[model samples]
Target: MRRIVPVLALGAGLSLALSGCFVNPLESITENLVEEGVEELIEGQTGVDIDVNGSGISLPDSWPSELPVPSEGTLQYSASIGETFSAQYEVSGRGTFDDLVSKLEAAGFENTGEIEYGGLTSTALETERWQVSIVYIDGEDSTPAALQYSIVDKDAP
Candidate 1:
C-alpha cells in the first residue's frame, strides 16, 4: 500500500503538469486557429474577405474606396443569429449610398434592383461571386446611409 500511494501521487502530479502544457495548444487551435481557418474557408468559398473585428460583421474586399466610413462605423461578425458573417459601413453624408452603388458598378457589379419601404431605400448590386446592398432612409434629416455586404458558404457546416 505504501508503494502504491507513492506511485499514484507521482502519476497524479505528472498528469497535472502535463495537462497544463497540452491545454494551451488545444485551446489555441480550437479558438484562434479555428476562427482563422473558418475565415480562410469563407474567403475561399465566397471570394470575399472576412474581417471579424468582434464589432458587428465582416467586410468584403476593397470596401468604401470612394465612400467614407462613418465616424462610428461598425464592422464585425453578423449581429443576427445563424448568420455566419456580414458587414455594414454607415455614412452620414449626402448621396453616400449612390456613391457606393457607383463604386460597385465600376467594379463590374450590375445594379440588380432597388427596394423601398417605410421611407427607406435598399439598392442591391451583384456579381458572379458576391452581392452588396446599400440602404438608407429617404428624406431623413440625418442622411444616415449604410452599405451592407454579405457572403455565406452554403457548404460550410
Candidate 2:
C-alpha cells in the first residue's frame, strides 16, 4: 500500500503536468491510460482484480470511450447512460480532492460553485464538452469519506 501510493501520486503528477501530450487525436488513449494505470496499481498493491468495463452498471449503447477515471482511487461503482457517466470512488491521500480541483481548473473548467441536497454535498464544474459534479460526504467519527462523480457530455441532449 505504501509503495503503491507514491507510484500512483507520481503517475497522477506526470499525467497532469504533461496532459497536453495526450490531447486531441490521442484523447481517447488518455482515458485508457488512466483506467489501465488504476487497474495495475490496484492489482499490484492489493491483489484486487479491478475491472475496466465490468462496472456492470447500465450504460448507453453508444457512450463515449474518452472519459477519464482517477488513477489513484478505488472505484466503488460506476454507471453510464445516454451521454452521462457516473461513479463512486474511495479516494486515498489527503489532497486528492484538491488535486482534482486543480486539474479541472487548469483545463479551463469553470467552477460553477457547489450544491447541497439530501444530506450530500457536490461541487460542480463545466467545460464545453463536459459537465462534471463530484458529490461527497467528509469523514466523521468512524465513517470514512465517500465520493461520487458524474460527468455528462454537454453537447449531447
Candidate 3:
C-alpha cells in the first residue's frame, strides 16, 4: 500500500516533468543564441547591421523610410549599411517575386534594366532617391524559388 503511493507520486511527477518536453519539442535555445551571436559578430566586423530571423523579416531602423519592403516572404536575411539596405527571402505561398515587382512599380520605382539567363531574372529599378535591384529564381525541379531585393541611396557618397 505504501509502495503504491510512491509509485503514483513518481508517475505524477514524471507526467508533469515530461509535459514541458512536448510543448517545446525540438526547440533549440542554443541554436537561437548561436544565430544571434553570429548576427552580432557580423554586424561588429562589418559596418552592416543584419537580421536572420526566418519567421518574419523587417527592414533595419537605419533603412530609408521612403522604400517599401514586402512582407509575404520568409525573410532569410536583411542587411543595412549606411544608405544601402538589402534582403533575401524564400518565396512562399503568401507572395511571389512578381507580386513584389508590381508592388515596387506601384510605389513609383522606374524599371532601369532587366536580364534573364538560365532561369534567373534580375531587374534593376530606381526611384527619385534610390536605386533598387530585384532578383529571383524561376521554379526549377532541384532548387526552391528565392528572391533578393536591394536598395541604395542615389545621393549617398
Candidate 4:
C-alpha cells in the first residue's frame, strides 16, 4: 500500500504538469505569429473585420487584394468553442469543391470531409488543433474564385 501511494502521487503530479502545456489553438497561433513578427505580415497583407457568430467567426472583408481579386468569394471564418480569437483565410476560383479541398490539403491542412453551407458545398479539414473550411464561387467577371478559413485553437495539440 505504501509503494502504491507514491506511484499514484507521482502519476497525478505528472498529469497535472502535462495539462499545463495544453494551450488553446487560436491563442497558440496568435502567440507564435507575434513572437515571429508575423502579425505585421498579416496587418500589411490585408485588413480584417471580425464577427462572432455561434461556433464561427465571420470576416466580411478578410482579404482585400485587388490584383489577385479573390475570384468571387466571401470571407472564411473558423474558431473553437473557447477560443477568444479565430483564424481566417480567403480563396477564390470557380471549380468543384474537391479542388479547394486538394489545395488546402496540399497546404498542410488535413482533410476531414465535406459539408453544405446555404446550399453551397464546402470541404472541411482539421489539424491537431485547428479547423478549416473551403468553398469556391464565380467571380463578378465570371472568373473563378475560392474562399477558405483556418481556425486555430489557442490550445492546439
Model number with the top lDDT: 3
Between candidates 1 and 4, which one is better according to lDDT? Answer: 1
Q: How far is candidate 4 from the true structure (C-alpha RMSD, Å)?
A: 17.2
lDDT of 4 by residue, 67-155 (tens): 12222334443322223223333344434455556655766777778766553566667666556555544345643344544343435
TM-score of each: 0.41, 0.52, 0.70, 0.33
lDDT tens readout by residue for model 2, 36-112: 67656644654333344323533233445554445456665454444566666666543556666667777788999
Model 3 gets an lDDT of 0.68
| Cα lDDT tens digits for candidate 1, 30-88 | 55554555555545544434543343454444443433333444442332112223455
Q: Ranking by TM-score, best first?
A: 3, 2, 1, 4
Flag the better candidate by lDDT, 2 or 3. 3
Q: For each candidate in turn, give its C-alpha RMSD to the true structure in angstroms.
A: 17.5, 15.7, 17.0, 17.2
Error of 4 at 30 (Å): 35
Q: Which parts of model 3 are misplaced by more than 4 Å?
A: 1-27, 93-95
How would you order the candidates by lDDT, starting with the best? 3, 2, 1, 4
Candidate 1 deviant stretches above 4 angstroms? 1-85, 138-145, 152-157
TM-score-best of 1 and 2: 2
How many residue pairs collide in each prediction?
4, 1, 0, 21
**Residue 30, model 1: Cα distance from true site in angstroms:** 25
Give the CA lDDT, 0 to 100, for residue 117 in model 1. Answer: 82
